[model samples]
Target: MTDHETNETAAEVKVDRQRPETPSYEEVLFYERKPAGFWVRFWAYLIDLLVVTALTSILVKPVFALVGLETSGVPWYAPYAILSALIFYGYFVLMTKFFRQTVGKMIMGIRVVSLKTDDLSWMTLLFREWIGRFISVTIWPLYWIVGFTPLKQGVHDYIADTTVVHEESFRKNKLLQKKTPDGSGLHETSAF
Candidate 1:
């Protein structure tokens, strides 16, 4: 080999293109596969609609009249759309940020969680709330599709990379666990 070629080979760095030994990307998907039942999710969504409607009625609905904003007052929309968007966006921000539960999800014992990580962030919640409305509202079939989606996601869930999972009942868990302080089998551990 030429001296220059030998020198070039010696200077070159050998690199192994291998990923780090950690969880796979799929394993870390936020939505997960724990699908919520149809009826369960449906009722929870209804609860959310009622709450949002009530809140929007109080806030956005009044704003139009107060500001003397009318359907003909503007060029584009009937003003109701603006009100709807205000309620839609505002309701989501409040529910996910403050309570971490919309009325429907709370009642049904299901929750929205981030798809990328275990923690639920405001951004994820916002995406889910806004996008979810599109799928959750349109019709029953669409809503069912979300529940049946492989990842347990509705439209918003898919868009936001989020998931809805059933919350384990605390009361049931407490009842089932009659344990000892040292962590032994139930029979020996049962103080109750």
Candidate 2:
């Protein structure tokens, strides 16, 4: 290389290292994600629940009707509980891992992210969701409260170190409304 080219390269390299660090607020603006609050998260949650319910109902009810199994030997509520569990859990796993949100969340333009980083993974999604079903259901009559909890985290979220967050617009709207990621006014912290 020519001497002039080498000098220019050296000057650029030095300038790169001398750049000042961006502050936390700047990082938050750029990255530094926060969890969604209860209800906005709830909106997404309700969407998922509704979708899952509609789907499983569509799939299961017809089969029962076609085969006359509704009252053949299987009970009505039994199918609802057992089938709902499988459908909901399966739907939760698929959407959270692959799509990073359910149909409702997708419509709402919200997604879940890692607690510290703004990324998602299958393992993270699986563990967080499985823990969600186990802990939230086992602890209460319904897993509904998880949607009401701060960060929209239920008991399992505590175990998984995960948090649900709304889309960027939702968070900004939340800040403006003095509401939560879910649009609730609840003041809360993580399980820790």
| TM-scores, all models, native as reference | 0.57, 0.58
- Of candidate 1, the 10-residue stretch with the lowest lDDT total is 23-32
lDDT per residue as tens, model 2, 78-131 = 865677678888998898788777888887777767675666666667677877
Tens digits of lDDT, candidate 1, 1-192 = 999998777666332224333321211112223557667777876787788778777877677778876633454356677767677778766776676667788777777667689777777776676666656666646666764666557777777787677776321211223344444544322211
With a 3 Å backbone cut-off (N, CA, C), the pairs that clash in candidate 2 are 36-165, 37-181, 37-182, 39-182, 40-182
**Span of ten consecutive residues with least summed lDDT in model 2:** 22-31
TM-score of 2: 0.58
Task: List residue ranges in candidate 2 displaced over 4 A.
Answer: 1-31, 71-80, 116-119, 138-152, 170-192
Question: Could you give the C-alpha RMSD of every candidate to the true structure, in order shown?
Answer: 16.3, 16.0
lDDT (C-alpha, whole model) for all candidates: 0.64, 0.67
**Model 2 residue-pair collision total:** 5
